[model samples]
Target: MTPSTTHAQHPVGSGFTPASTVDDVLEGIDLTGKNVIITGGHSGLGLVATRALAKAGARVTIGSRDTDRAEQAVSGIGDVEVRQLDLLQPDSIDAFVARYLDSGRPLHILINNAGFPGLGGIVRDARGYEAQFAANHLGHFQLTLGLYPALRAAGGARVVTTTSGAQRVSDILWDDPHFTTGRYDPGLAYPQSKTANVLFTVELDRRWAADGIRAYAPHPGIVPATAFNRSVGEEAQRAMGLIDASGEPVIDPDRGKKTPEQGAATIVFAATSPLLADIGGVYLNNSDISPLDEDPRPVDLTDPDTEVPVDVVPHSIDPRSARRLWELSERLIKSPSA
Candidate 1:
């Protein structure tokens, strides 16, 4: 089957607004027997999404690098199970996939929501790929492909990757993806990974629609509570105007931050909405399909006045680039680390 297409991105009048909660998106929908795997469900938006889905009757598994932390986090957040997955390690991803496949369960939903906080410097994986790209893009790429059998067995499935408005600011940095000759900046690496998320959805949808798999990339909105700034440093936050000169977080009403429930709403919407049954590979925000970029200008990540652009950048959804990214990811996954 050819990939389903929608002409433009506008509010579908999803009846759920930017302020809608996860409960709002899930209203009247019963996932009773469905099975879902949410990576990074230990905290932030992923943890909350797990809670909502589990409460709605889906069998939820929280895949994390720290299984103990994940298990403890979700111990009271409905009946969520836990699995081990370190997205930074290919072996860890393989082990996680193998365990899931061994269970003989169909994967109704796969949420690739785990990500690295900006470390403000370059970190490389064993394979010499940029760590952010490896964890946020390549790891999920390998995991999704490894779980293909489970996804196919379900007969129909939805894959939702948590992309960001940051995607609008960057491209793949294809010529020097690992920054060998180019200057290394985690700020650049971070958005580049987000761009990969968008392209991955586009290419995955094109290749797997016939197999009954549909993919979505949703921006969970400006979720400060779930952000990695604390781990990165106050200077980075201060630089972004997220913190004041006194080292206090700036609460700018113009930069509205979503509550955890509100943050998870778009993810739930993308995964379960009947509104999107016929749509695949569309980027979403505020629980609505996002408009394609009419203006493709890149946003500067370091500018205090600059906000993360929510619209899909033109290059992010470019078919040719998406295909190239998919191939690039495959090679990176297969490379032998010296």
Candidate 2:
């Protein structure tokens, strides 16, 4: 069957809700003999996904900047291995891909789950590209392209990139994505990278679906226990209603707040759901495809009552923009320093 060309950003009634856990998504699904690699699979939502996928009978490999820490974190998980992968470094990405391909394993799933929240003030990589853009988007871009052989060899594969609702807040800063001209704000930079993720997914699926490789960008919702949220400090978390006055996490999946297991549901769904076999190049949220919502709204993080929009926006899924970003990313990765 041919893949669908339409980028329909609407729910398919996945039968899973925002509160669904990883086990819920993996229910009645068997991944035995499947080979999967997940970036940052040893921590937070990634870790939860790793455990769930591994439990489903897949041989899982985790790519982490800190192999020692990743190993310790996944020590209890069976059928899982950890490898060194620093997304900030091109050589590290290449090395990780090389080692995986050398094993001659057909990769059934590749989850680009590692990300830089861009909490610290503007940071740049060796290529002088914005750290968040470089690590979160370009690094995964290079990694996925490098693993093309294995993915194609699998005959059927899925690439799930961990995006966020933040994609709604900003489009790609096409003029100066690296923030080379204006003052760099982590707030803007992080969302720009996230938008790039969705764009990358759109273009990837369009290009590779013929080869039986599909792509997905899933918003895991607001997982407060993640290192990204924890770094914001307790006071700020409280102000955002991520936590209470007593420092307890607020589990409200409807408003995007969720536990780690709940947050990983959509990601796992994107990777394994049979319902999505014919669908590609769509943004997912709450364990299902999100409907397009271009409604403009302020992203006031301080306002706990404000429900942040998690739906797909036109700019992020625009074919022209997606193609443009793919070309731009190609140039960026081919630069003399890159």
lDDT values for all models? 0.84, 0.92
Model 2: runs farther than 4 Å from truth? 1-6, 299-303, 336-338
Candidate 1 collision pairs: none
Model 2 residue 62 lDDT score? 96
Runs with alpha carbons beyond 4 Å of true place in candidate 1: 1-10, 234-256, 298-308, 336-338
Model 1 has an lDDT value of 0.84
TM-score per model over all chains: 0.90, 0.96
Every candidate's CA RMSD:
3.1, 2.6
Residues 172-284, model 2: lDDT tens digits: 99888998889987778999999999999999999999999999999999999888888889988888888988888999998899999999999999999999999999999
lDDT computed for candidate 2: 0.92
User: Tens digit of lDDT per residue, candidate 1, span 155-191?
Assistant: 9999999999888778999888888888898768989
